[model samples]
Target: MNNRLFLKEVDQRISQADLHKVDNAVFVLHDQLNMQVWPEWVREEKPPLVFIEAKAKGDSLPYHKKKITYVLSSMRHFAVECQQEGYPVYYYSTDQHYDDGLSDILESHPDLVLTFMTPSEWDSRERLREVKSSFGDRVKEIPNQFFFADPDAWKDNIEPGYRMEYFYRDMRKKTGYLMNGDEPEGGEWNYDEDNRESLPKGYDVPEITGVEPDDITNEVIQMVEEYHPNNFGVLDDFRYAVTREQALQLLDEFIEERLADFGPYEDAMATDEPTLFHTNLSIYLNNGLLLPWEICERAIQAYENDKAPINSVEGLVRQILGWREFVRIYYEAMMPEVRDTNFLDFDGALPELFWSGNTKMHCLQQSLKPVIEQGYSHHIQRLMVLSNFSNLTKTDPRELNKWFWLAYVDAYEWVVLPNVLGMSTFADGGILASKPYVSSGNYINKMSNYCTSCEYSVTKKTGEGACPFNYLYWNFVDEQREAFEVSGRNSFMVNMYDKKSDEDKKAIKESTNQFLNQLDRYSG
Candidate 1:
């Protein structure tokens, strides 16, 4: 088949009104809610269907190449599936902004009414709003049904400064997951204590299975390479599942092979192993390839069959049902203003080492290697190594957030904002977390094997050859003493800092300042 000619024919048919028998059309965005050609409401109506996969504007932020390929290829494959089902599918690919592409579509059919599912991201939602305003009643937005929980219902239950624990419990009761009638399984709401063990030395890590790139994915990889050469991550070995079947297979593999051990080592990291018994299912989950409810149900089944521990199953379920849903609600509740939040008033620039992964710190280096290569590193690596260092050095939370948006395959504004600004950096002033996640090298050393190979000594608190996290953590504590003292959960850390001798505090402050001052010159 001549691909160029096929695309040209589709483009020509887009503007010909006589070819489309239906007046109304549903526009399917790149993220497929399911394998369906159209929503049930529109299927019987037999309206025309338009599936758009446009390359949006704003080349300023270079997305990870794998991300570009994943979204586009998945979208293209969905369009093909729709076409095979005998729907009038219009697949639009372009370099212009999404709005521009939509305008072109509007020009083709002047009287056409377009319907869409409410978008997930704030910016895209805003764009859709503008389009709606322009078209008036002709544009319709249906409630996004892709999510496991209802956002409005979740928001209604939330009080000011509501904690995720409460929301999690409510979800547990509602879903009847890990529950024995009115009581939680094992008479507990959480099994986090049992899930914090580090990976023992010489443990055999299971090989991860990944979907191979087919012709469609290969074409997308080539397009990203040629059009966005300077994108953040390398595009080689692109293995993310783009179709619903492939995604389900990947989820089954995780449940069977990795879920049993995921809980204990969920927070652990290693020098060479990036996944470390963790479910790398966030990419699939965020992209709508797998529903949160189904994933959680499968985990519960694993526990029922005695294939995995209760701790592991509950831990995995909590992330999707509790943390994931909570973050989405939080992001929606605190947007526009949340983007500019700087609770600690941190203003440091993101270091060059974050981009180059050339830092002397082995933890940061090892963590960043996977991010630059595969657009992934587990949550522990994100929290302990990347965000911890940034918080200690006072790197601007907004800058770090933007970097995360560009670097990770799973990142979306709804997910990235709360995790980075609220949870990771404490830039939201205790909105998502009671205490800052800031920690010294001790935490890293306790959790992973990274400290064993570091050039800097994890034990040294200050001066040359000392871990930068040591002094930087102390300096951050001293600098934010007033805030920490007032924080209910973090007051103990302030009291700890106050007990340190005056001489020790002074040395810590000096080392911190010296290291921060020369940070620009210390890049790899």
Candidate 2:
């Protein structure tokens, strides 16, 4: 937002004659690393590629170190690859913002017209538009090629309050993925009911074979260590794929080794098992190393070959074709307003346990530890454990959203905003989720191994030594009974809460207040 471009130096290789010789150049963001998503002119012209490593963006939050390392490393590697492929690259290691970097590029190259594909996130697109406004017709923006459906496509088809299932079915019909003529492949739009089984004891969990860091990544890791010495999480075993080929290999590995069981144990969690049959390709997919249609097609192919069940393939497809696209569109539709919406008016600060992982609660410990260590966790751990606990304790949705954005490897504002404020916390007033995803220890006990070795007893419903979730969930429901009753689908939760005896209700309130006050003492 500041005019800090004057502080940074332009690459010496980009001379005025070179700029005049170039008719057009393409601006590449950190996320748009793949050539497949480039403008059509890019391939023919083989024009200069401009990349900016904006340190200001990295400094916006105390981001996980591995996340910073992965993004910068990938961008550096892609720039190197582009140079090797006979393209001139102006790589700027700037301490300024993206707009400053773009302004410098335009000012340095007066004769050179710039072409850029639309960035995935809203803020990035807006920044680019601001730069374009300054440059007039010298800049051109193209459609984004990474996603299966354009965000604009939803303008006529859907709105904020629409359920994802309906939109997912529409996507299925539009893409003809998992569709058998007019009906769904299994005569159902979703296979979620078949995809909730817990992992069996001693199940053979496949080892994740991650991509070892190359010299480029190692350099970026050192750079991160030097610049972000005090950032969240360590970069000890950095194994994220930095290239399109490596990302494809990870996709293949997921389909071959894990896709079959992905449906059965998709929701399951275990101690020290962070991935657990889930495809850890979100890092690549969120960037442009992998495309959505290709990922969905591969899953569908696996199902058609009888290598995976329909439930597994359909579930995977639903994630990309259904949930991912839906959330992105929903974020676009509700943004700048959705970011601050707190329908429940939750005002508690995020617990210190989220950052320190200093908790006796087994589920929180197991879930938060991996995130603190690796900047990664499966969706259930995110939805059921992290967000569920935060919602029950009345943590401010914005604080939880910021923590997620700062912590996760795959997080960006566009995706994290809707999932946290809308689905996870119900901060959007049941627009994105029909009901809040709050739950007691029962769900965690059923879906994960965390409860087995927990300090708190899952068997006990309420009182001392009982699971905090049990009492906290009822307390939330009791406190928000009017809202629950107003939401037609979850009014039964209020009815269930009313059935408890007066003595039990008092115990529940007491235990929740005690736990919350203790949390506030330490964190708030």
> Which predicted model would earn the best TM-score?
2
Q: Check candidate 2 and list the clashing pairs.
A: none
lDDT for each residue of candidate 2 in 120-183, tens digit (9 for 90 to 100): 7777889899999999999999888877777877845444458898889988998899988879
lDDT of 1 by residue, 29-133 (tens): 665446433367676664556765555543647889888888777776666665655566766655565655666677677877788888888887888778888
Question: What C-alpha lDDT does candidate 2 achieve relative to the native structure?
Answer: 0.85
Cα distance off (Å), candidate 2, residue 446: 0.9
Q: Count the backbone clashes (under 3 Å) in each candidate.
A: 0, 0
- List the RMSD of every prediction in angstroms: 3.1, 3.0
Worst 10 residues of 2 by lDDT: 7-16
Candidate 2: TM-score? Answer: 0.95
